[model samples]
Target: MEDGKIKGKAMVLSGFDQEESAREALEQALKEAGLAREAIGIIVTTGNGRKAISFAKGDVTEARAAALGAVFLYPTARTVIDVGAEESRAIKCDATGKVLDFAVNEKCAAGSGAFTEAMARALEVPLEELGPLSLRATQTIPMNAQCAVFAESEVISLIHSKTEKADIARAVHDGLSSRVVAMVRRVGLNTELVLIGGVAHNPGFVESFKRTVGLDDVRTAAEPDFVGAIGAALAAAE
Candidate 1:
């Protein structure tokens, strides 16, 4: 960021080597901005591997970063839902972007992007195709498995029963959304709900979350995955 304005952005998948991925992403962003590493003022890191970033000037909680990022993008956003590969979180913040309350589903894969990935593989579909494919569903089917392991079994059973892949995919999203919505309820939903993190790219999960939360309008940034990084930068600026 330059003078509190976004100059460049980069999104790289978090690999087993968190520090390496972070460095790669930072380098990409610097290249995009045509800036040297020495030009950077301060570096703040957040998310699961924040502390692993050796060059970071500071680190902040994912919830705090998410709240700041959401409010920065959508000033009116009071509720923030960040769904990532390993965990999903719900944060309630005020107009000034102060986190008032928060909840996380760290223990459950059922509420995370990983669950969708597993389901997609079980259905023999690509990760990116799962969302669009689910849109063609003709009905809503219940997925009873709360565990990812058992959920895969349930999906295979449905497949054997001649159930449409679309319906099964929809059910997978619905099940995940149900878990996420329940976590959001702990923090309380507010107007101008903003969704961030990698999972925001999935239209199936977005649609299911909207339906489950009973909200027609859930806001998302153009590059939702960068929200947390933007928040970390904002924190660094301060």
Candidate 2:
């Protein structure tokens, strides 16, 4: 986290029963950035797993960190739509990278990445392939379920109906985008929209977001997942 840039990063997937994947990511980022643990100055943490890392000097909110991180990387960024594994949020930012307004969907699982994972499992398709496969669909399929549990059942029904997995995948992403779109609309769409978090890796979701929100030109950090970490580092530098 020197010079406002992540040095190295590592990740320990949930399968390992690890909460602070950043512990490994931090070591890797430091090594990648070419710094030793002792050489580091101060430690700052943010995001859902902040409490799991006992070594942090301080912590910041995800919206604050994400705003700063996106602005730091893309100077023109004004809004950030962060879709995480279990929750999603939309943040409106000003020129100075200060968050002006925000909306979060933490109560529901249907709008999060976990929903897509569940659908993929129901369709007997690999989770990683959901996004690309969804992109292959020629016609949009409507998904009515508003809950992940029901959505999972819906996906199973789609599979039983012999519906193309691609259409089902697209519908899943569209459902997520619809939820996120509601949040973004609440804050109002500003230029230089940015999408962050693990779900941004889903290309299908990205396109669905653009279409549903009616805004393309969405910006993303080079290391999208680390935007929050980058913002925390910038705060630490300050």
Candidate 3:
């Protein structure tokens, strides 16, 4: 998950259908990381267990503590926005990282890594090239919608119109940032807003976000995409 690094502890849980495999993978990862076997904890529960049982599972308790640690490290974080591959989460947490309130966009691909990847592919560029390319734009092209399908269609239109790739990419960044800003605003804007998830890696996305939200201080984790896992690991440490 660290892009090649295999250091650090991890507490992992797979879906209810893959509980056994998930446990095995966590245990093996712990061993490979040279962490103490006793430091590793495994808890397998059905989806119903998570829903019906409020009790903390073995490893989950630690994961929670780790998340809290990361939260505490940032003094001004009251809102944490995580944009992942398939879904997104806007978590409103206290100083302790307790989930005070939250919203998620899990049912669609419109505002996620998948959306950006699709756009990047359509533009004939590598995903990593997107941020820098967009940053080079001299003008802002308008992207009219948050819906991925609509946006893709719009991109085609731009291409046919001879719109500059840099301009179009900038528009895409603006569109995504607007969507994320809306989600964060729902939780109420807080100082030192933290942006997590794979999308945070995109400088264009981050810059657009800062501008759209009109926030002077927007921070990103060293490993933006892995904040959840890092937070989970930090929670486990506690």
lDDT of 3 at 112: 72
Tell me the tens digit of each residue's lDDT in model 3 across 1-238: 2322335544344455455544565567667677765654533232212333333253343224323534855656777777766767677778778867676666677777777887887788899999899999999877886788878888988999999999889898888778777887777877756777778888888888888999766898667644555554444444
Q: Compose the digit string of candidate 2's lDDT tens values, residues 153-202.
A: 99889889989888989999999899989988899888678899899998
Candidate 1 lDDT, 1-238, residue by residue in tens: 9887998888788899999999999999999999999999999999999999998999999999999988988998999999999999999998877899999999678889999999999999999999999999999999999999999999999999999999999999999999999999898878578889888999999999889999887887678888888889999999
For candidate 1, the 10 contiguous residues with the lowest summed lDDT are 216-225
Q: What global local distance difference test value does model 3 have?
A: 0.68
The predicted structure with the larger lDDT, 1 or 3, is: 1
TM-score of each: 0.98, 0.93, 0.77
Ranking by TM-score: 1, 2, 3
Enumerate residue pairs that collide in model 3.
62-235, 62-236, 63-235, 63-236, 64-235, 65-235, 66-234, 66-235, 67-235
Model 1 CA lDDT for position 135: 92
TM-score of 2: 0.93
The candidate maximizing TM-score is: 1
Candidate 3: residue 221 lDDT (0-100): 69
